[model samples]
Target: MSFESEESKKLGGIKLSTLTQRLAYAGIKEQKAALSRKATDNNIKQIQAAIMLQFGKLPAPAKIWANVRHKDFTRQVRNFMWKSIHSAHRIGTFWKHIPECEDRGICQFCNEPEDLEHIVLKCRRPGQKEIWALAKELWLKKHPSWPVLSLGSILGCGLTTFRNNNGQPLVGASRLYRILISESLFMIWKIRNNSVIKREGAAVPAHEIHNKWLYAINLRLNFDRALTNHAKFGKQNSIKTPLVLQTWSSTLMEEDKLPENWIRAPRVLVGTEQQSSHHPSPPPGRRGRNR
Candidate 1:
């Protein structure tokens, strides 16, 4: 039955069933908007100054979601990516700006300022560089022409482009790119929190970080496999499985269940000679120093 000509749906005591509720909701929304405006306008300039100094102008809204095809990543990881894009995720440098407390904003491992970029991409804390280097290597293998990563690009590279050297569109690779960057960033955030919060200054090893990365990617790859595996094999498959299989079968790996191809980023041997001048090893006795 049409409700337009009848009494509206009602709830306990509230005018939820009627146009009155709509008016109430509008009033509430307007009040919230006005309060927010008052807050920003009347507050000290520190909030704006801090944002301008560190993250710069707000990033433009993402023009695309390159991972629209992939559905295996968790809601939490996606949320982290959303925050990372605008540089809203917390880091030591952000804490240092608060007027109530004194934080030096230095990275515990590198002694450099611990900004979001440093923690997510360049942190020399036990596991960070190795994890990122592995992420970069795998990303390059799949997308050899992708530009060297910057903090901004790491967060939003999926929307940046999907092309190669000749500018031809690289259609499906964008999904893989999204996983590589977002998963790597998520792992780094975990490592950072472990060092700062849970570990209470203890270092997390590179291999441990590598293992977590492995577990995460393997989980997603397996989910993708299950999706693309046909009902003819036994169980119901996702509707998109056929479409994904058409493009995925020959590129990333040969075997249907093989995760090694997609999760191939290697773990850095903590003290290996690969740690060079630019990414120098810490002195003999320092925590997280290779060898």
Candidate 2:
């Protein structure tokens, strides 16, 4: 039977069923129209902005559905935004291992809704400051002019490429910035979990976290060096240049003071001689340095 006929029969002369069906359909139609109108208005505003800046403009209706034709651009924008907002998933199996908080189902470290923001930015656990400080340093290295606020803003800006006043792309140093941002956040989350779950009440030291970050940075720099060397010499067997290695190694050791044993390593002897003699050694007559 036709829908109209079925509705009429169900109403039994009152037509209540038909009326209800019509009302529901009308409500859906109105909602669609309202959303279309809102999109149309937004497009108009964007067009106006473009026209004022003499960059050409899209018609209101066309702009509203531009994603249909410009699928790649739309998808790239969507993915970039998604990654910027959700960068905490970089560490292998870190989030997966986070047990639900007993009280509010939150991650025990960050304690703010148990999501990316909480774990990286809002976590109040000890030694969290080091992760935040490292993140800030990375940001400043990439964007000297950017204002440092919460970790979320830092990651967002790092992941996104913005146009300057002159329409230049003010992005991070490289595409690898996304990976670095994710790794840093994941490292913080892992350290927090390790301290809370395995170590009981013992906190992960900030210096340890910094060392891990430096190691990751050094590994990436070395990989880059190897790739560049291979490209330049057209041979994988060719060793990386001492100059490039020296530059990267110095950068890795910039903030870290290596132990006496590390300082005396064969590789260290070939590099810079500016190594710090102070390696967290015990006080003159004391056992180990106080915790």
List the candidate 2 regions with Cα displacement exceeding 4 Å: 1-101, 104-113, 138-142, 146-159, 162-166, 170-176, 229-291
lDDT of 2 by residue, 69-111 (tens): 2221223344433443333233322344356524334545544
Estimate, for each residue in 1-291, the C-alpha lDDT of model 1 and write its tens digit.
Answer: 665632345333344565475777877678766754553332223223332343353332223243322353467777776554334555654467577643546787788878777786677677667666656545554554435566655655444336667877665566666666677777888888888889986887656666677666655555665554456455554535543442233334334455433323233111112332245434433432121
TM-score: model 1 vs. ground truth: 0.56
Q: What's the lDDT for all of these models?
A: 0.55, 0.45
Any idea what lDDT model 1 has?
0.55
Clashes in each model (backbone N, CA, C under 3 Å)?
1, 1
What candidate 1 gets wrong by more than 4 Å, as runs, is 1-73, 97-100, 164-167, 229-239, 242-291
Task: Give me the candidate number with maximum TM-score.
Answer: 1
TM-score of each: 0.56, 0.43
